[model samples]
Target: MQNSFEYGSTRVKPQRFGDWVIEEITVSEDEAKFFNMRQAFQGKHSEMITAGKFLRLMQVSTGYTVMSNTPMELKSNEIAFKNARGSVLIAGLGMGMILEAMLTKSEVTHIRIIEADMAIIQYVGNFFKDDPRVEIIHGDIHEYEPASDEQYDYIWIDIWDDIDVRNIEQMAELNERFSNHCINMNLWSMDLLGCEPEDYYKIAM
Candidate 1:
């Protein structure tokens, strides 16, 4: 789908860091107004409403959702990418933002992306189709089993719809089972805030 945010008349070249490229676009005031109006009608409040600037990663297929301009989301990306290394496994591929960031890290060797939705895979696949370091697996995380010979150095999970105790438990369980021998395992819901597993469950209950 075409992005609802209008890219103003500015020739901004995409910036490349390692294997990842990011394009900066000017978000027109008119588009922002329309987006706010649509959100109001839908009774939704989004921090992603473009005001002046927006970033577009070439690796993502879903144009609108792929835009990353929010401060909180950007900070989360920073934390996640900083900890990524070696043969990595990511559970969710939302807009491929985390994937793009991880690709920029020289420490990351091979990345295995497991996405349950075929449409998301098809959309984001266009960006990384030529990259030999990436392997896209179409499967559900809950039922996923790594080959006996396969082992990852990092397992990052971000499939939760939102942060809650149940989601934390499920993600922790996945990590325990799939990445027991991995060097590191992280969850987007937990790692970003530096929240301990015990603390999270305690507060959640």
Candidate 2:
């Protein structure tokens, strides 16, 4: 990953929403052995990571669904992380991973985050509550719309539980709402589909 953050910066009690809980998770060495290298960043890496381990920050839902700061998640968001600049708006605050990553870039002047789950904002969002340049909102990405005069340099949509070809429809609806609100916007996993973030516009069209 291109940016690193100190997980210890924030001290808060564990928070949960339904079956999802915002907390740290330790992955065993045996679990790391089966990692798909294609999904993780290979160089420099991020902070708090060891050779056989991943970052501890994570949000776990029922059935062991995880949203974490693991290398795999970093790799998936890397392109957007590098391309993001100026005022950025990110949907889905998963363990505040991408939100914290954006803090490392001086070029990013402001960050606005929207997450559907209030528990996530109460939990993961607490870490950034003191940052003047960041705003955390509780809202649904599918129904939320930006203010009329507000615009962002970049926008990232990452609300899905997982990447699926069926996500294209929702992405298109997002494009319709945000196309003019941002100079460039992206949906996560477009790169995994063998398309650049910019290509997302074309792919959806």
Candidate 3:
């Protein structure tokens, strides 16, 4: 953990796993170093690395979502879930911070979390074992099939391996399929800084 920097609306911190310092900014096109770093940190599963108030989800593989439970990130999702009630479906479970924030709202009755990684589910599940409102389902959001009778009042999709245009478009497509039309549907957007797609590539390069 290191001092934090302001990245768009969120406070970004550098996460050190061995020799690799995982910064908030997008890495260069050459991902070999990051891949190797992932290998080094792979065996350390569900180890919640903290810097200030943020929680870092370190994984063993590359090309997966890189998330930090920053206050700005948590606040945005919390505000979105303010009026949320009945049933809410969350597509990605990072560190369970968002889920915890949602629980603070009395309107929210049930929360179903879909996570692709069982390790993450196991790790995060420990924090909410006593809560009856939370349900963890191990499955990819793309392959997840809700019960025929189930309907969510809010659908939030935050799965992002990278914040590129293609990934953003994929999230949009998934939201269209799974989101309840009558209520609110939210997808994590990388356009937080109002930068164009080309600008992101420029920064990464």
Two-way TM-score contest, 1 vs 2, winner: 2
Please report, in order, the local distance difference test score of every candidate based on alpha carbons: 0.64, 0.68, 0.58
Ranking by lDDT: 2, 1, 3
Error of 3 at 167 (Å): 1.7
Give the Å error, residue 104, model 2: 1.9
By TM-score, the best candidate is: 2
Listing every candidate in turn, what is its Cα RMSD in Å to the true structure after a full C-alpha superposition?
9.5, 5.6, 12.0
lDDT of 1 by residue, 2-79 (tens): 233221211223554333346666768797779778867865443336567655644443332333544435654555
Error of 3 at 138 (Å): 0.6
1-205: candidate 3 lDDT, tens digit per residue? 1134232122223444432233453334345345445645864222223234334556645534366655445544554456456778888876666776677667788988888877666666667878899998889988876666677777777787444567755754565566434266666653442435342221111
Q: Which ranges in model 2 have alpha carbons more than 4 Å from their true place?
A: 1-18, 23-30, 35-51, 55-61, 194-199, 202-205
Give me the displacement of residue 2 in model 3, in angstroms: 30
Candidate 2 lDDT over 1-205, as tens digits, reads 3434553223344455655655556666655543434235443222123234333433454455555566556666776677678999898887776777678778999998888878778767878889888998899988887789989988988877666667777877887788788877878876554554564642223
Q: Is candidate 2 or candidate 3 better by TM-score?
A: 2
Worst ten in a row by lDDT for model 3: 1-10
Give the clash count for each candidate.
Answer: 0, 0, 0
